[model samples]
Target: MRLEGVFARYGRRDAWVLQNVDGEVRQGDTIVITGRNGAGKSTLLRVLAGLLPVGRGKVRDRPDIVGWVPERFPTAQPFAVLAYLQGIARVQGLSQSLAQKTIDAWGERFFLTPFFATPLEELSKGTARKVGLIQALLNPPQLLVMDEPWEGLDAQSQAELPAVVEELTKNGGSCVLTDHRGRAADLGDVRHWQVHQGVLKEEDAPAPQEDAEHHVIEIVVRTDEVGTTVEWLREAGYDVHGTRERR
Candidate 1:
């Protein structure tokens, strides 16, 4: 997706929250938006999710299948966990059987299966966030937008969330997310963007090493594929040694 001179604000009378923001989001890109509180980070995410309209300029090539996990998961909703996720699946164009299967799979993956029958209002904050995250992935989206998705999640869930995002990008999708606590340490390869005074700029990636050095790396494989694995490794510029059988 590409943003060209994009400008946005809450209302016509309100001051602009984003002004002349320009950037491009490519496939497999993990973009992180960082800024102080009330600096329009959420608004920028809303725009990218196609929830907020641009006041001027253009945001083109946005994916139609956009999945967004808001910072605040609405707990006042009346639907139960499974029902709500099934509804989201239907909205994402899944059939009834497929929707149920997806709900079951994601519910188990996120540890929300036990609470499948519980109403959204009855769940704890962490559980509610899990439901929120699950809804976003009922159908793998082409663009996944998350605002503080790591908040309120347990240690295990927090660790798993980055892996989920990596899977999306690996499948040729993209992600845009914001977090304040620096909890997303696993997303080290992300493009860091800081929004300030309604302007956006790409932070430079770390420089590469100037010196070349060789380091020892150990390889282990099954006996059957040892020859092929060793040959491939050596072709890729690795120093290969004879394989030793382990007792």
Candidate 2:
């Protein structure tokens, strides 16, 4: 997908938030958008996600499935959390049993199962953002767009996001996201863009150190410790996987 000379604003009377922007998000691509507050980064993300129509030019070759997560999850809806997620799953083409099962698994992964049945309006900001994230992740999206996705997440949830995006890109999917907290610095080999003064600029990636060497070591811990063992690994941006040991 590509943005071609796009110009956009919130309303007819509002000043243009993005002007003559051009970019490409190709298969296996992870593009990170960054800028100071109110610098039109969010607007550019919306345009990429096809949520906001551009005032001029166009986004070409959009994917069929797009997962869009806003900066703030809206909590004014009238549905319970689980029910809302179920609806999204159905829309995303999951069967009832699959939806429930998937939701259950992700709920546990994000530590959100306790609030599964809670009303949306009653949940905290962080929890509400989890709802938005889980819905987008209910199914793999050809294009994933998240605006400030790490803003209100817990440490564990925040750690889980990069893995999700990496998996998608690994599968020839495309992702565009915003990171305001500088937490995405370790996301690994991603295209970085700055949206400033209604224009977009691509930043050059740092050159890799020729002498850098990384080693992987696996250790088995006590069963009880397994529950929390991956935290540090995830924080340090190491890939974590579970496997069965042969007898």
Candidate 3:
């Protein structure tokens, strides 16, 4: 999928959210978008997903197989959690049984099984976000676009997301995602781009350093054992700093 000279504006006479943005993502690859608040990262994802119309550019992609996980899920829905996702799957061309099975599998993985029969309005913010995420992955779309996919998620849920992304890429699928927590590092061999001042630029991250001298070390011995460890280190001629206990 690719966008050629894409430009987007939110409202009449408003400043352009995206200006002359060009981006490409081939199958089996992941693109990570990073920027400060209001940098148009989410807008770019929407454009690529074909959810928002572009102002003055061409977005060429397989729309039929694109799945989008918006930043916020619609909370006013009258459908149950599983039913809503199943509905999306059905629209994506899955059979009724297949859609139900897919929803069940993902619901189980995301710990949404208990909430399967619950209405979306009754779920918490974090759980709603999970539902949005699962809906995007249920049908294995060719292109997946996610915005803040890991936001408001618990630690276990956050850890499970990388596996889902890996499955998508391994199946020759592509994804464009925006995240604030730097979880994109878990995507492995992903291309990083940053939006700055309405311009999209390719950015290179520094390689991880292994030199011990350049690293900050934290020794977390228990409070009772800290004194012993510090004393032992000092006796071994190490530059150790110790604090006494308040009697």
Candidate 4:
């Protein structure tokens, strides 16, 4: 998909949230969008998802499928979480039983199985975000757009996001995501773009050092013997690194 001179405005004003934004994303690519607040990061993602109309220029795509997950998950529905995910699955053209099965599987992966019957309005913020993310990935779209997918997630859930991105890209899917935390390092070889003043620019930074050498050492000491261990090591004329004692 590509956007050429794209511009968008929320109201009748010449000030566009996105102005003259031009970019291209090929299949199996993961592009990370970064910017400060109100830099039109989310606006650009919505435009790419076709949720917002572009006021000027054009967005061209020949996608076989598309999926989107906003920064904020909608949790005002009266239906159960599983039922809501099932609805999304149906929209993706899955059979009823298939949809339920897929939802169940994702629930287990995201640790949301306990909340299957819970109402959408009753879940915590992180859990709701998980539901939104799973809905987008249940059927695997050709294009996936996510906004702040790591927000409000616990340590475990945060660790799982990179794996999900890996699976999508492995299947020839593409992704455009905006995040403030800049934690996409685990995605591996991602193309980084910065949105500034309603424009997107590619950042040219030096490549990471791949052949750097590193070392690791482990030691075990008896309880309350940490000071003695450090003193003995120092007396032996060995270079001692830092030390820590865990209760």
Candidate 1 lDDT over 1-247, as tens digits, reads 9999999999999999999999999999999888888888999999999999999999999997899999778989889888888888887899999889888888777878999999999876678888989888988899999998877665567778888999999999999999776655678688988899899998864344475776776767898988567645633435454678877
Off by over 4 Å in 1: 205-247
| lDDT, candidate 4, 10-32, per-residue tens | 88766888989999989999989
Off by over 4 Å in 3: 206-247
lDDT score of residue 13 within candidate 1: 97
Show where candidate 2 strays beyond 4 Å. Answer: 206-247
Q: If candidate 3 were superposed on the true structure by all CA atoms, what would the RMSD be?
A: 9.7
Cα RMSD for predicted model 1: 12.2
Please provide, for model 3 over 25-73, each residue's C-alpha lDDT reduced to its tens digit, 9 standing for 90 to 100: 8998788998889888888888888878888888887546788888778
TM-score for all models, in order of appearance? 0.81, 0.81, 0.81, 0.81
lDDT of 1 at 162: 80
Candidate 3 structure lDDT: 0.80
RMSD of each: 12.2, 7.8, 9.7, 9.9
lDDT against the true structure, per candidate, is 0.85, 0.85, 0.80, 0.82
- lDDT computed for candidate 1: 0.85
Cα lDDT tens digits for candidate 2, 1-247: 9889999999999999999999999999988887888899989988988889999998999998999999789999999999999999998899999999999988998889999789999987778989999998898889999988877676778889888888899999998988855667767879999888999989986344474586768888776676355544543445566635535
Q: What is the lDDT of residue 226 in candidate 4?
A: 73
Worst 10 residues of 1 by lDDT: 232-241
Model 4 alpha-carbon drift over 4 Å, by segment: 205-247
